[model samples]
Target: MPDESATLALGAALWPQLPVTGCVYLSGDLGAGKTTLVRGLLRAAGHDGAVRSPTYTLIEPYELVGRQVFHLDLYRLGDPEELEFIGLRELLGQGLLLVEWPAQGRGVLPAPDWTIDLAADGQGRQATLAIQ
Candidate 1:
């Protein structure tokens, strides 16, 4: 994958492969196209609205796509406990969770069923997938 299109394509391809209700960990550096991939997946899943990074909000909830979906960006997370305050535990096992900066949530978040790691490769980005 050398560009955003490829990343998006990969995301779209994951539409059918992704679990309807489970955890997915997305990790990568800045500009690694993590959110772009999410946007793509959302779009493929029939989301009509914009898919914004939950950088400030910490979490973005998406519904009506046959299941609940939460996109979490913990880059600015002050404490992982904040997730509990936000009712994350209630959302667990109910739908899909696409988590970025997952390392920040460590002990608070549940074990991810899948992990997607993206890295910049100078000319493009390299993506690695881990299935647990």
Candidate 2:
């Protein structure tokens, strides 16, 4: 596992090398810095806007360096059925997706191309990243 900033930077650096058509699922507990990682990614991608969790809205879209980036927080989702109502299918195919609390969506969501798991370790964190 890597440190928080390193993990976020690694993820950002790897962004350009990714498939260019898949999602990245972030599985971890609350306060895990998932959004922080995403903020780093967006900043690396040349975005300067405030990066906030999409907890209440479910998803937030950003246009960065000519690419679309989607950050999703599924913590409030009660069921997978709600995905269709939010037009998930349409937004997914065209952007880089960074999802938090992915277990909440389960079957309704697509298989992730990569997975990032963050856990607290004392004052810092342990981040495990898997690319499949």
Candidate 3:
């Protein structure tokens, strides 16, 4: 998109079409706006509070708009096996799962239903979505 607002709008537009239960892997380098996109998606789902990256915690769970949503940032993960320690297995299929740095959790994380890859493009970002 052309700007952060555009990126957020793309996410807002996606809210209705997104399945309530599925995995979405967000791929991108640092400062690529992955969390910003997720923030927009959640806002469309009626979340009025802050939407911050769960970089340190690894997972941020949101019980919103009548469903569960979990955002995970695995950049700090030392190993894929660490996901099990965070109860990822139990969270699977329970709600919408948005994962960042999924490459870090390759073996432990389930295959995503959707993948969003973001990259810098001029002053904005280029986001590509893939269904798998």
Candidate 4:
């Protein structure tokens, strides 16, 4: 994608292709458009509220008309075990999960069904998707 808009468009296109219930890991550095893409997904899924990174909150839950989506940013996680306190297992069984900085969750997080990696490419960005 050449910019955030393009990245968001890609995310909108990818929303319907996503499984009803599964995990997606988003890998990218700060300002890499990870949250922008996630915002795209949420908007496509009928979310009209502001979409913000859960960097400090750790997780944000969105309950749409027909589905539930959880966006997690584990960047500041002190330890993977912290996930246990957040009902991670229960959420995995109920809705779609979009995890950013997934490595921070490591052993505590479930295996993702898809992994999307983003990076800076000049003034634009590059995205790679892997299905597991």
lDDT scores for all predictions? 0.92, 0.83, 0.93, 0.93
Instruction: Compose the digit string of candidate 1's lDDT tens values, residues 1-26.
Output: 88899999999999789999999999
* Prediction 2 TM-score vs. true: 0.89
Better of 1 and 2 by TM-score: 1
Candidate 2 residue 57 Cα shift, in angstroms, is: 0.5
- In the range 75-122, model 4's lDDT, one tens digit per residue, is 999999999998898897798999999999999898999999999987
Candidate 3 off by > 4 Å:
none
Q: Whole-model lDDT, candidate 3?
A: 0.93
Which regions of candidate 4 deviate over 4 angstroms? none
Global lDDT for candidate 1? 0.92
Q: Which RMSD does model 4 reach against the true structure? A: 0.8
Q: How close is candidate 1 to the true structure, as a TM-score?
A: 0.96
Clash count per candidate: 0, 0, 0, 0
Q: Per-residue error at 104 for model 2, in Å?
A: 0.7
lDDT (0-100) at residue 49 of candidate 1? 96
